[model samples]
Target: MRTTRRWWVPAVAVAVIAAVLPVTPATAQPVSAGPGPVVADGVTQPVFGYADAIRERIFVTSDVDTDADGALDVVAMDIIRPRASEQGLRVPVVMDASPYFSTVCRGNDSECKADLDGDGLNDRWPLFYDNYFVPRGYAVILLDMIGTNNSTGCPVTGGRADNISAPTGIDWLNGRRKGVDAEGNEVVADWHNGRTGMIGKSYDGTLANAAAATGVDGLTTIVPISAISNWYDYSRSNGLVTRANNYSGSLANNVTNPDRRQYCAPVRTQLGQGGDDATGDYNDFWAERDYLPHAGQVKASVFVVHGINDDNVRADHFSKWWYALAEQNVTRKLWLTGTGHIDPFDFRRAEWVRTLHRWFDFWLHGIDNGIMREPAVDVERLPDVWETHADWPLPGSRPTQVFLRPGTDGGPGGLSVRSGPGNRSATFRDTPTMSQATAIRHPSDSSANTENRLVFLSAPLTAPLHISGTPIVRIKASVDGTDTSFAGLLVDYGTRERFSTSGDGIQTRSTEDCWGEAATFGGYAEEGCYRQTVKTVASNPQELVTKGVVDGLNLDSLFVSTPLVPGAKYGVDVPLMPEDYVFETGHQIGVVLLGSYSGYSSRAKQTRSQITVHFDSTRITLPVVGGRQAAVAAGLG
Candidate 1:
């Protein structure tokens, strides 16, 4: 039920395959035994030259006139392929179509696309994709998103204009769309085999999601790292606007800065209205930007990489998308880490590049590398330690409900497998002035300042308890006023060292390592080398596993608003953020309920509204790794 629309067509018009891949001669290292690029082991070799790769600039037309210029928009594309493609070698494409190429830089190093000669062709490419992949017989295209950097139109975050930018270029590569050069001369991807794989981080990755969702033919695979699939989930959650006013417009403006977005002033204003910050409801405006409902349209295989601790894009985006993809029987893979909004190339460097190379070879070049035969998921649960699984949520993972009980002698309540006494209930006054941390932590303080929240804890775990998926907290509560919000935090109460979401959770090492090939422009050597990073860790008494907050009016549905009556209980189902965390032995599970969570929302107008909870009717259903027996064995009962 995650998706209601069927947007994917069963059959797409794919390009005809005519050419057969050539094999390289064996040398000191292992070479190709069959078709496709030369492989030493499972990965393709850097046989094609990069320093003299065929680099050119072109434009592809797209639908919509975002700038109100009365003409269809054109996206600026910069292509880099192996010079061997100029001969008779037909190579696959790897594209990083990005909106950040102009206004903002990407990754920890803050790198951006550079055009030294101002001729639309890039003098320097961001990241190491070009240096690494071009030599491996793949073409890496750096696309300037519509309305930014030599492209025409306005950038409206996840709207149609922004989503189709990459797909149109894919169409051009497949000879289905018109493309022109710097002098307006027609240009066709004559050397391309019509197999394309999109990869990027953040907004760039977001475009990859958009492209795959369009069911665009010839797009064989996508590696979306820390990307957003639903814009509504990005800015709003269950009728609560999580971001500032006009977030879509502000984000659009930021990505197209330095006067490129000048003529798109009116378009920006319209985008602000489309967000509907005041009501925070799902409407047609949000529908155009949401890719979740259209998840069935995905035809390409997905290799999803996301930070489990990424609050910017949130983990729910990937989890929900994965669920939808699973329902559609889409081939997929997952990589979950303990870092923030960062690319795996920076953290997991060696493995990521190697795995990614094999992935592209298998999908784009049809190399039959047996990547799909491997485990479907790689999870980094304990800091640097990693484990592989058949799929996410684990095979034995199932829903386990835990009841929230009241304190016996006016202390903290308990979490039990059996339902608590129906007669008892807890109440907390709305406190917008208090921080979310103060509301959830320090339950033993006995201070009146913390009375604005209710805390529930379970007995210390005797065994490791794994919470592998999304946790739903269904509460029957009554608020004194209609303008109140509620929040719940799933906590791991134990003193230990863990990865913190603060910063990038890394320290820059002195040694620098290079990826792919080096380049020089105007005697300046761009060695493609980068300083390595080590994951940072922090020790704390407790770690916040996941959180969920909701506006009191959105008890039933996100699109519908129902006002809460005074002293009338209503069922409020709050789904916490998706998480893959393990509570070790001796650690306790904690849940905190607060009014007006100040850390996420600012709509707690008066902060005087008090909430009354019904203990018997409220329960948290967690997707536990081993189901009910696992909870009881961990001492929850």
Candidate 2:
């Protein structure tokens, strides 16, 4: 794939405040207001777009009872339905509470609650709701879930135990005369009408996941974007406890200061943070109420999307659900890019809108538009390259392993795989080499505690190997201290620069169940622990760090995820942590020996902790492909 360089232009996040000015007695709560011919404003804004025609004024009905008392004695909503068509009917609904009425919507910035787009019309709730749900030719239903703005009651973001509002929303639609189906059936009149699909980003995405998990009647499809599926993984990656960035405790601060305590109280209760409780596991109360468990049970199809470089929620979430869905044999699609959390600025907004319209048309309209038949995975690699794979990891990739070995020459000595378990180790001088830009360990050396790295190489491959999938690095190691940390890096030896070809998807292969589904290529048979899938070999240099971890006197194997390239020679480099460590007088640094890839390196960057790993037995695990093995499987010569 050819890479192109494009400057990233992030959209400015404008804070929109609500228009909470007191209504004059002259133009108070309306009795009857006709649909007006509202003209567009001259100003153009970043997020707000122009529509061919605006439904100007909606004569919505509303009720309000001012009190902190636990009584939702109010109702308000605008009706926006598509004109009945000769072919099919479409309906959509949008909802938001306070900000649409009061100035403090979503905690900060009253402008966000007003006419955010500067369209000369207030659409705080309208546009935000339609951004995700209302496609062309669909009837729209907007509800004041808790009846905040013009309505009354506790506006449920998605729903509540006592008030499963999402299904209630569907109920409202089917009850409308215009929403009835062919058999003279009021679509929303019955609770058993077809399921309702909920879609949105950020707050809306989380609610969709919650509604889907609740298994509410008439709740069919929910598309949760940039949301946390497993609360534990969301708070903890691998097994390490992460800073509580996405939880209620961190977010409650944003709500409290603004006196939006109305929204805060219910959200905190739902998160279980206010009740001296812990919402920890995937099986816990919060997850039960919100988490979409088995991908197989997703009765409603989901088009999961996420930004790879999201500082808020992280893109690892996409991997979690994508693998789960694949395991459940469910067909789902993913759109992954390197962008900020709130806005997917990776692609133009129009492209995103078009894709969603096509998706909604196929599933909601029953148009047989063949959108579902598209590729399962679409990824945007860095620099710039958008690719579509029939399936993740692409197809026809073969497995090839490059052993990490100690070497006297700058090049890593080529190591080979054996029929049974085997081990080897090598040592290199502690000194800095190569440009600082490509160095794995920083600050080269500190005091007499010298730090050094090794570079091992693999013999050139004879064939054009396709290595588009994931590969594993196995290293057996032991350390001299009570604690140690190991890290791995794959490098290309053919080019003088020793660049790394390990792309976005390549990762350390620990348990085979990494992908869950059994891949036909990799000779490594499937097991319950398998979690990921790897592809074949390419014609570039390759290398892998078999292990990187910190522990005492442990004989374990580590797996490093690094793909390989054919023809060009490959190599491995393992640097002692002291090379990157700042030795504090009393603290001692020790190299850790390992046989497997460690998650220690992954979190070390986040936690800013020092770690070192010493390697003892390092070997390569190659999936035998095409030779005798392929012939035996296919009965070919």
Candidate 3:
């Protein structure tokens, strides 16, 4: 074991928007078309040489000292830029800040930061940013999240140390801060063209969100893939402890450099205590990690990406963040892929690179690319099918309401558009022993349903059913105890192929697709390239579209808990993640109610108290295309 748990790393998006006009470069240096990138055909040309691109390391001091060590912590910034930067040519930057540079890796290929020649410097940058973008006049920087790798400080999960560390690189680039070489000699980013773009997946992406939320100057754009906007949402669901207690601390300790682990032990203790898993209430700790509150301050143009099938980070992270950015009317674009926690570089490949290139050029290089003029999103409906939508919630989309009706003697219920067969109630006891996999397994089979879960299925759809945007499920139920947990799952029942989680949908060929600057170690290929995933036929009868869970007492307030009156009816809301799916003809939409869900959150504890569903008014609101009429026409009734 290199360290603890499944070590994570970072993702990089879809669609190419052709430039609206070919203009002179006007990015960092304010010269024509700016810096040294050769512009042709509305995009930056790869005319710069990758072999001699200047590669070096520097330490950018951060504003935080999590350990109370008096001195500010310094983050490790590894750089690889076009050699033109060393001369009079300046360039914009694309940076990814991640903790996995030390212990974990990224993507399906398990790629990590490497020192190919062991020169104590990163020779082989993870992914293809350095290999592909360095030659295109973009300085690709990989920052070692403070407290990990060669950076100084303690990893505080998403606290100031983690959230505020990486942006120092931006600060240095913009002349807001000064960096130093290994020997402590002052180093200034005089070569930096003022504009910068941050890109990453998972925790790496979370940092980008944090950086943008700060409204930091010079950070003109960000491409956050499968990222988090709120730390509390990552650990809890509707004020219920879904992840294990002390997860914040555990994760902090997991990513910290081994040498400094002991020094940061106290900080880890505080992080765990601050999470307040016992009550699972939002507190100062989670507030510090949340970026949404600061969304109003963001000035960067966001190019956000998320995996619709991703269960690890979940789709809610993107949905909430998207809405927040939208409310602020911030310039933004989105990409929803069918892959689970996978990068577009691996899933979409060439298109991702091209669109990302255009996005950086548009935002960072001040290019007149019509990327913003293009559809706001490129959404993947299937492995081979992608659609470009003008924006989220395709036009005429609205929340369609659906209700649960009684079944034949506790077998399974039917979902109906007609409401108020009122006063009819369905009941089920809490089954803590049932795993989430078993609870939601194969909804088409009646054997999968028991007293542990209440399954409701809609009629076969006569027309196509398209669901986009966030869906909300509110349960009108009563429980036996003062507090209990509930789970609601939205299911798609039909035979179709979807993104496979267990690699059954992909086959590794003997031939490998090589990439990067072609640097190799003693025997290993350190060019950040490998032959990984390929699409294969994968099908299933039923798939989990989304799920939401909540604690009864915390439904109204995540920061406070209210004990329930025995056998009293109350509306318990389960915040389902966002989704973009199209249910074909003959497919049925299903909803499952459970006492808890281990499938969604592995550590979610089951509520042992009995729970009941009052069929009178409980309903789920789906963002279905064409609203109620389309839902009725599609058999969503």
**What lDDT score belongs to each candidate, Candidate 1 first?**
0.81, 0.36, 0.78
lDDT of 3 by residue, 507-589 (tens): 56556665546544334554646665676556888887888888777867888988889899898777788888888899888
Candidate with the greatest lDDT versus the true structure: 1
State TM-scores per candidate.
Answer: 0.93, 0.53, 0.91
Cα displacement (Å) at residue 631, model 1: 0.7
Model 3: residues with Cα > 4 Å off, grouped in runs: 1-35, 114-120, 441-450, 504-510, 519-528
* Residue 141, candidate 2: C-alpha displacement in angstroms: 5.7
User: For model 2, how does the per-residue alpha-carbon lDDT over 281-311 read when each residue is reduced to its tens digit?
Assistant: 2233333333546455555556677655454
Ten contiguous residues with the weakest lDDT in model 3: 1-10
In what order do the candidates fall by lDDT, top score first? 1, 3, 2
- For candidate 1, the lDDT comes to 0.81
Highest TM-score: which candidate? Answer: 1
